[model samples]
Target chain A: MVRWEPGTAERLQKVALELFATRGYEQTTAAEIAQAVGLTERTFFRHFSDKREVLFQGQELLVQAFLDGIEAAPEDASPFEVVACALRSAATFFPDERRPHSRTRQSVIDRNPALQEREHHKLTTLATTVATALRARGVDDVAATLAAESGATVFGIAFTRWLREERSLADIAAEVLAELLTLAARALRPAR
Target chain B: MVRWEPGTAERLQKVALELFATRGYEQTTAAEIAQAVGLTERTFFRHFSDKREVLFQGQELLVQAFLDGIEAAPEDASPFEVVACALRSAATFFPDERRPHSRTRQSVIDRNPALQEREHHKLTTLATTVATALRARGVDDVAATLAAESGATVFGIAFTRWLREERSLADIAAEVLAELLTLAARALRPAR
Candidate 1:
């Protein structure tokens, strides 16, 4: 999706996170955030339906894009491999410079339950979409669900590492995914 | 910690899920559920604050109880050991025969974004709480976070397995945690 209101959405989100941290998420109002950005409540609604939504708009896009990518991926790929590749493909959407902003956004979501929940919904939706794509490619329902949901575990690791300033998102993602493959191999291994 | 309105909650959940399946989640009303249950709308509100909350009330308590178990564990235990033990301890709270109900409940949440978000909030809160508990036991923040969050990943695996009717919740949880530990150790293997 194109960025509407140009920098206005990010501006409001930045102000909202700052206000939420200082004054608390519950204490901050959309009106206050909009006013801080020299915009009206109507403008705030136009950008984000609610303060919680501000923390999640990019994530929603990420989910949709990642799902779309999976749907368009080649047929006959392993379910986990397909979703993993799709997850990696999303790296282009998150540049190295976005790390600081990404961490700050996570912090805001971390502090508030409502925002956190919205984020979780987006994530779960992404996983399910991946699973559906897998099923379409001939993976059974059980394996599809496992592949898609388990892939989120690796994604979470990549995402957390991406937020750190030192490692590039691409590098961290590669490392985490390599580790996830290792983990999966071990999970599939019978106790010896 | 306790099971109040056990059969009522379980029954209401089933009827609601069936309604959701047939008529869609948004169109279903509290009045309809109440009438289906041979209860009044007041009774439905008494059990659940709102229609959405109905699907969510027990999980927070469950995760919190699991965290509390870990925090109260022996001081010298490894992080995974504590979490695994905590999960085993928490198993005492589950009903003896409710796999079908559990699966159905998850299906309901899976279909509804709002409900799914609430479930995510509960899960993230549990991980944070588990991390805090580890810190209280003198573990540092990063390791504790990794252990706590990874423990949750294990729990997620165990939870998915438990929802399947193939095995009892307690037994599947034990096996799955073992699987997670193996997976985690591979993911976090120390450099030689």
Candidate 2:
């Protein structure tokens, strides 16, 4: 097993986001980011593959959290229940302590169209992953896809709100999921 | 109003997809695509801003179809009803006659990560456009977002099926939307 360097990656990510935010993502270099954290350029490369990777670090862990959430749900849980569990579980990855960091990271991503596209791609991948997990649990293909994609949409909206609001990420995600369910129900109602 | 050059854009897109498929997207150039269509590079530039644009031509029309669908729905239609109407309207843009062309275009996009990212971005934009249209019709913010996103997901899955199945895009999208609603209801049900 690879010995994980715990704080190094997190430190590099935090420093990189700060530099990217202040100097502009395009203006900042890997070397400059590494220097800001008192690390050598080579040390920075050891933690991240590229400058963009810094902003996207921990994505795998986030995806895994969603998957783990799926795994942790009750075996007899409804598809929506499974998804709700997953969202609540994934929200643990972004506690109150991470709000400022997330906000800065989002700000950096928003200014760059390329980064925004990358973020979109990531969310699409997350939805696909969640759908596959549901399928593994015996959910039908279309149903699994709809639930997973809806879950992704809920998570995304909630995450954005969490960055700006005082509420915890878990609380925000739960409320968002409830709102989504309510909206879906309202839409499904027959027109008078 | 500017006089439209009929058949030019469609013809260029066809030739470009063929070249991108057989010759590889990276190997083909805008000039070559134009030449294959018996047009000058300037004319090609007039049709598309870049080589990648050839595969994505008519996206604006597709978005417009969705918006028009929203507008065509009854003023008192539920959010889901509005989305369903929009999806059906958008399906008219992907008739059976266009499936082979769409398949070829999608195949070419599948092989290129950059093109895939562009497609994701386009879908995101479509959802946002649909949501805004719903909001204009007085749908609540989260309801509009959920309905629009669900509509986009239904469209995407149905479009994939349309490429391979004998069913019309409209039929497939309507069925898919129905399936999604059913899934959402199932998930929302209290666990036994």
Individual DockQ of the candidates?
A: 0.12, 0.65
Candidate 2 lDDT, A1-192, residue by residue in tens: 112345978788878888889999999999998888799999999978899998887688889999999999999887888999999888888878778878999999999988997897788999999999999999988888888998999988888889889999899898888777766677678757
Best by TM-score: 2
lDDT of 1 by residue, B1-192 (tens): 555565876678779878877787799998899899898899888888988866776776787678777867777776656776677767766655656667777887788877766676676777888888888888765556656666665566667767765766567777766554443344344533
Interface RMSDs of the predictions, in order, are 6.2, 1.6
Shift in Å, residue B62, candidate 2: 0.6
lDDT of 1 by residue, A37-119 (tens): 89999999998977777767776567765666577666655565566567766665677766766777787778876676566
Worst lDDT window (10 residues) for model 2 chain A?
A1-10
Which window of ten consecutive residues has the lowest lDDT sum in model 1 chain A?
A: A183-192
Clashes of 2: 0
User: Taking the tens digit of each residue's C-alpha lDDT, what string does model 2 give over B1-192?
Assistant: 112245989788878889989999999999999999789999999989998888887788899889889999999888888998999889888778778888898999899988887897788899999999999999988778888888999998898889989999999999988887776677778768
DockQ of 1: 0.12
Tell me the TM-score of candidate 2's A chain: 0.93
